[model samples]
Target: MARIITLTVNPAIDKSTTVAGIGPNTKLRCTQPTFDAGGGGINVSRAIKKLGGTSLCSYFSGGPSGAYLKQLLDEKDIEQSITPIKGFTRENLAVTDTSTNQQYRFGMPGPPIQEAEWQNALKQLELQLNKGDYLVASGKLPPNIPDDFYVKISRIAENKEALFILDTSGEALIKAAKSRVYMLKPNLAELGALCGVTSITDLDLKSLAQEFLENNDCQILVVSLGPKGALLVTKNEMVQVPAPVVHQKSTIGAGDSMVAGMVMSLIWGKSLVDMVRYGVACGTAATMHHGTQLCIKEDADKLYEWIKQQAPILETN
Candidate 1:
């Protein structure tokens, strides 16, 4: 079996709570908070396990919060590989307003990483990756980390002959686009930025996607369209994967869940179309729950069937 490894440079301990209502400058009571292991790659690994798949979750661990994060994942039997650091890992919070069904999220900055710390992380990741492996690296760059951090990982993947799936934004996205990437999961805004445009309408969505694939070495480009599903673009094929609507509670971790589903589909030797459809299914399923909870297997499986029945808007060049 080809190994599946996920690397989250900036990991977190996610805390979620529910309050009766939210108001400005007023005291409100909240329910007991629930804590979970978080960050992009961590969530992907967690979702994969939820779907009865396994992945090695690798991340930076620092301070007591990082320890707690590891403990949370350990409880779920999600295998983890840690890279010790001097700075504390971040802790993010989400508070749900019961009255309005609105979720407010607060994100903290990750601790600044020293040059040696990040360099060591790269060395460890390169050592762990092997040919035919699937390496999923997700989340934003932290303080003191270079924008080209992922570019280095891309090179490592290229040398190792591993498939690199990247999910990130900002300058990191801009630089990594020029590197060798097997797949990219960027939101519509990020995709537009890659195309060097400020806006993209439905009329030109396919064109921009084509342009991205043509101008870069990316084999697969998955532009997440939120509730509308995602657009999957390859060298010769482009299709809009439709998502089934559901009662949405929270949108956290939806993208990571989507990536996890797609990776699992690949592991199962499914076709490209099936892989993206299952990804859309998992993304939609993530919205049906509160907090940072990802897609459950039952929900994702049911949604996958619904997505398969719906006709995909497609084209083949």
Candidate 2:
């Protein structure tokens, strides 16, 4: 089995709860909060496990909150590697309004990472990665970390001859796009940014995606389209994978679930067409749960079967 490793530079302890109503200057009663270990790569690792796969989750740890995050992952039986830091980890809150069925999230800026801390993380990741491994680096950069941090990680992946999968945004995404990346899972907005355009229409999407793969060092581009599903673009093929409609309870962790699905498909040596289809299934399945529960294997399997029956929108542009 090929070793899979996920790197989350900024991980968090997520607290989720539901309230009857949300209004200013009102004392609304909230249900008991539930906690989960969260971050882009962390959630991907969790989703992979839920789908009956294993991955090594490596992240920066500090203070009590960081310890709690590790404990949460430990309870789930997910293997992990911890890099100690001086600053405490962050916490995020998700509150769902029962009145409007809308969720409000409050995110905290993680502790400022010291120069040594960030560099140490890179060294640790380099040591853990091996040839033919999959190195997944996701989530936002913490305070004080340079925007080119992921670009450096891309170099490390290259040195190890590992496949680098990046899911991030803003300058970080743009900087890393210049490096040799095996895969990128970006939403339409992120894709537009990569193309140096403010907007993208349905007609221009295929051309732009093809242009990205042609111009950049990325091998695969998966542009997520929310409820519409995702567009998978490669050098030789381009297709739009449609998503199945489901009762949406929350949108959190959907993208991570999708990445997990696609990576697992690659591990299984599935075709790119089927990989994107399964990815769409996992993302759609994630919406069927409340809070950050993510996708269940049974739901993903059923949705994947349905998606397999649909003809993908092939683009030859």
Candidate 3:
């Protein structure tokens, strides 16, 4: 078993294509579509593989779409464990308008998971996790599942003495943060939501991040700042990782790529500052491509070196 295991409860087959122009009606013909296996944890697994690391991806599945998702992972040589379900997995679409260089994304709500199916997923996770392992539970909970689902997973991780890394939103994220989690990667807006504030200014961001770490069982909080950069906050210190400017292609799977970089860095025993630097590098590299391509190892490595030379850690007071 790989030391890292990822769980994506709401997985999807991501289909992307391009159109010359996107206008209302008038028969807009799209180019040939490309499909990729996606979901928060699955994308993390894919990015890890791209970074020359290995992890087991566990997710729910059913129907032809689910089988296709597994096939996509197999093609990428990513290891996976599937929990069969009754509902077919959902598919999301992304159409890029070539003329305007604008990408329009359409996300679908995943199929509702039955009680037994979700419980079975938990049982599978319990079987896979071990001491000192990293369990990354990401993506949203499917409809009809309880909001406290990740909370239960957190408990399992605690019992196994595994580190739980959570990347999610809304109620699922809110409830799970109260449990024993090792880290959280929330975007600026999601961090604002977690802090119960409608807005978070630059001055208050670090303070709020510090407060969350102090209060919650979560040991590390990484607030992704998109084009600007990311903030890595712990109980002891805070470091701001600046992102290098690059030709933007697509933002899909960027966050998962960032998480993958940081986890791989941790496994390699890099410093926390270097971990966030590599994470920002992977995320920026992911945007230098289209669709769900994620980060390439060469690009990420170059960016990591560039960031290290130009960006320095600012020790927060």
Candidate 4:
């Protein structure tokens, strides 16, 4: 078993293609379509694999689409443990308009999970984890699942003395934060939602991040700021990682890849500052790819060096 395990409660088959242009009620000719097994944790696992690390990805799947998702993972040589549900897994579509150079995404709600099915999935996770391991719970919960699902799983990791890294939003994130997780990865918007702030300007981001760390027992907070970069906040210090300016082909899965890079660095005993640096590299790499294609190892390494060269000095007040 790998030392790191990622949990994604809701998964999907993501299909993407390009069209000349997009307009309402207009016929559009799509180019070749691409598909990938997608979910927050799954993308993290994929990014980890790209960075020459291994992690087990656990998620829920069912019916034909689920079967295809499993096959997709197999093709990527990714290790996975999927809980079989009754309904078919959902499919998400992303269409890029070449003429306008704009991308549009259509997402479908995933299949609803039953109580017994969810319990069985938890049992599977319990069987895999042990002391000193790391459990990464990412993404949203499906319908009929409790909001505190990650919280319950965090307790299990706690019982085993494993580190629990939570990447989620809304009530699920709030509930899991109450468990005093090892790390919480939230974008600026999600952080604002948690802090009741509508917009997270550069001047207010650091203070807001500190407030969350103070109020919640969270050990570390990583607030992603998109083009502005990410802020890493710990009890003792705060560091802002600046991303390199790159021509972005896609921004999807950037956060997941960033989490994977940070977690991998942590497992390797890297310093928090270096971890955030590599995280920025991973995120930048993800944007260099098209559609759902995540960061490649070479891109991550190249960007890592560039980030280290311009390392941001952290302050401790």
Candidate 5:
């Protein structure tokens, strides 16, 4: 089997804590806090591991926090390749209010990357990639990195005959879309940003998704709609996969888990429709857990069956 590889240029230590409730100027007693290695691609790799799959996760790590991130990944038994740099990685905080069941996230900007360090990371990625492998480049581009970084990675994938998957937003996504990619996963907001749409209701989502596939070199476009489910758009067809209704604990890693599920299914040569079905299942399962814990294999299996039973018949325009 071809190995799965995930690249995250900007990574962080995700710390999540729970309190009874949240209010301004209120002294809240936080419950036990949880910390995990995080970034879009890292979360996907973690989710893949939770789903009984293996993946190689590569990212930019720097300073003391980078050491901790590597240690955390090591504890999880997730293989990784780190491109060490000078500045420390950023930390993200997530506060979950138990009383109202609301989750608030505070994210910080990552360290700036030197040109040499950025180029070195790209060289490492190119050297490691092989034919038939799956390469997922996700997350925001840190300052000092070129906007066309993903575009360069896509070209490397093309040269190696690898399957390239992109999960990003704005200019980075637009630039990467110019290359031939195996798949692109974008949340509703990101999709709207890509299509220059201010608001995307259910009515116009399918059309917008089709427009992307037609206009870009993307083979498949996956648009996630949180609890509403997701739409899978290909050149010839489209499918609507509904998320299983569940009491959500936190939605932090849901989208990343969805990408993991989809890529895992694709690596196994599952049909595109089945890939979306399992992706929704994984995403829904992730929301049932608190903190950075991703979708478990058992939950994904159960939800996969449920999603298949409730799958919507999509009408393509």
Candidate 6:
């Protein structure tokens, strides 16, 4: 089996709960909260585990919260490789308003990482990544972490002949897009940023994707279209896999789950079309649950079958 390795630079202890209502200046009674390991790559690893696949979850950790994050992943039976750091891990909160069934999420900025700490993380990647391995790096760069952090990781993956799959945003994402990668999962806004534009109209989406591919060393581009599903583009193929709509409880972790699904499909020796279709299934399945539960194997399996029954919308440039 090909190795799957996920790296989350800004891991968090995600706490979620439900409240009767939401208002300012009033004490609201909330239900007991649930805590889980979080961040982009970590969620991907958890989703893979949920789908009965294995991946090595790697990240920087420190302080009590970091220990708790490790404990949570352990409870889930997900393997981990952690690098010690001085800064404490961050925690995020999600509150569901039971009255309106709406979720309010509060995200915190991650602690600053020292130069040595981040460099050590890169060193660890160099040591752990093996050829043909899939290196999935996601999430934002923590405070003080360089914008080109993923770009550095891309170098290591290239030297090791590992496949680098990136899902991130902002300056870090812009910098990494300049390097070679096996795949990139960026939403519409991030794609626009990569194209040096403020927005991407659907009219020229394929053309822009083609232009990006032509200029970069990236092998695959998966642009997420939220509820409409995702567009998969490569040098030879272009496809739009429609997502199966579901009663969405929360959309948290959907993108990470999608990445996990696509990578797992590749590991299973499935075709690229199946990879994106399964990815869409997993992404949609994630919305069916609340509080970062990610996608269940059964739900994704059913959704994948449904997606296959419908023809994929194709595009040409």
Q: Looking at model 4, which ten-residue stretch has the lowest summed lDDT?
A: 308-317
What do the candidate models score in CA lDDT, each in turn? 0.93, 0.93, 0.93, 0.88, 0.90, 0.94
Error of 5 at 210 (Å): 1.2
Tens-place lDDT per residue, model 3, 99-193, is 99999999999999999999999999999899999999879888998999999999999999999999999999889988999999999888988
TM-score of 3: 0.98
Writing each residue's lDDT as its tens digit, candidate 5 over 56-161 gives 9999999889999999999999999999889899899999888988898998889999998989988998899999999998799988899999999999999999
After superposition, candidate 3 runs with Cα above 4 Å error: none
For all candidates, what are the clash counts? Answer: 0, 0, 0, 0, 0, 0
lDDT of 3: 0.93
Where model 6 places Cα greater than 4 Å from the true spot, the runs are none
lDDT of 6 at 313: 84
Q: Residues 36-59, candidate 2, lDDT per residue (tens digit)?
A: 999999999999999999999999
Better of 4 and 6 by TM-score: 6
Decoy 1 TM-score against native? 0.98
lDDT of 6 by residue, 1-317 (tens): 57999999999999999999999999999999999999999999999999999999999999999999999999999999998899899999999999999999999998899999988989888999999999999899899998889999999999999999999999999899999999999999999999999899889888999899999999999999989999999999999999988999999999999999999999999999899999999999999998989999999999999999997788664
RMSD vs true structure, all candidates: 0.8, 0.9, 1.0, 1.2, 1.3, 0.9
User: Which of candidates 4 and 5 is the stronger one according to lDDT?
Assistant: 5
Compared with the true structure, the alpha-carbon lDDT of candidate 5 equals 0.90
Candidate that scores best on lDDT: 6
Residue 194's lDDT in candidate 5:
85
User: Model 4 TM-score?
Assistant: 0.97
Q: Residue 102 in candidate 3 has what lDDT?
A: 99
Worst 10 residues of 5 by lDDT: 308-317
Which clashing pairs does model 6 show?
none
Q: How close to the true structure is residue 315 of candidate 1, measured as C-alpha lDDT?
A: 88
